[model samples]
Target: MAPKFFATRAHLLVCQGQSCQGRGSALLYKALWNHLERQSLAYYKKGGSLRLTESGCLGACSYGPTLCVYRPKPAGGGLEEAWYAAVDFPLATRIAGAAHEETPLPEEHRYGPE
Candidate 1:
């Protein structure tokens, strides 16, 4: 049997594909890490955890430096996903802050299909 896993309220996936990396995803990722760390949400072992991951292409190469946030459903169902594009350090910091506070993503930054 597969190992059981604990559920987190939020997950943030930053795209590190060639295009995104070229467009400064690394800087965005670093900014995100710093923000989460400051908010005490950097690691699962720490209090107020948030799962952060670096992913492959999210199929939005034209919108390099893309990111996706997964928020768990309140009714014990699957997660709700949101995609953001053209992320920079400041926007990345805001995203991290949103995850820390369990708030919705910034509307202006959202991209991809509905």
Candidate 2:
């Protein structure tokens, strides 16, 4: 069984695929990290609870910069995953903040006590 996490509200997946990168996903990725650091949110990393991940194409090339957030649903409910398109730095931060309050961390983000 996968180890249990600290019960994060959400995990953010930023598209670093070729198309998204061309549209500025790299900068967006940095912006997301900076935002989390600035807020000192509880990420899976040493500092915060938000998990920032680099993902492949989400199949929204026309939209370019796209991100997907997986939020854990309440008991008896399914995963509440949302896909965002044409995301910029500011929007990513806002979305992440909100989602962080609603979802649980993905299995990939769960790390053992350090």
The best candidate in terms of lDDT:
1
List all candidate RMSDs to the true structure: 2.5, 8.7
TM-score of each: 0.83, 0.77
Each model's C-alpha lDDT? 0.81, 0.74
Superposed by TM-score, candidate 1 places the C-alpha of residue 17 at a distance from the truth, in angstroms, of 0.5
Q: Least lDDT summed over 10 consecutive residues: which range in candidate 1?
A: 42-51
**Candidate 2 weakest ten by summed lDDT:** 105-114
Q: After superposition, how far is residue 65 of candidate 2 from its true place, in Å?
A: 0.1
**Residue 112 Cα positional deviation in candidate 2, in Å, after optimal superposition:** 32
Query: Model 1 over residues 1-114: C-alpha lDDT tens digits?
Result: 997675566889999999999999987887887777777787544676677899999999988799998887667687778899888877777776777677876777687447
Clashes of 2: 8
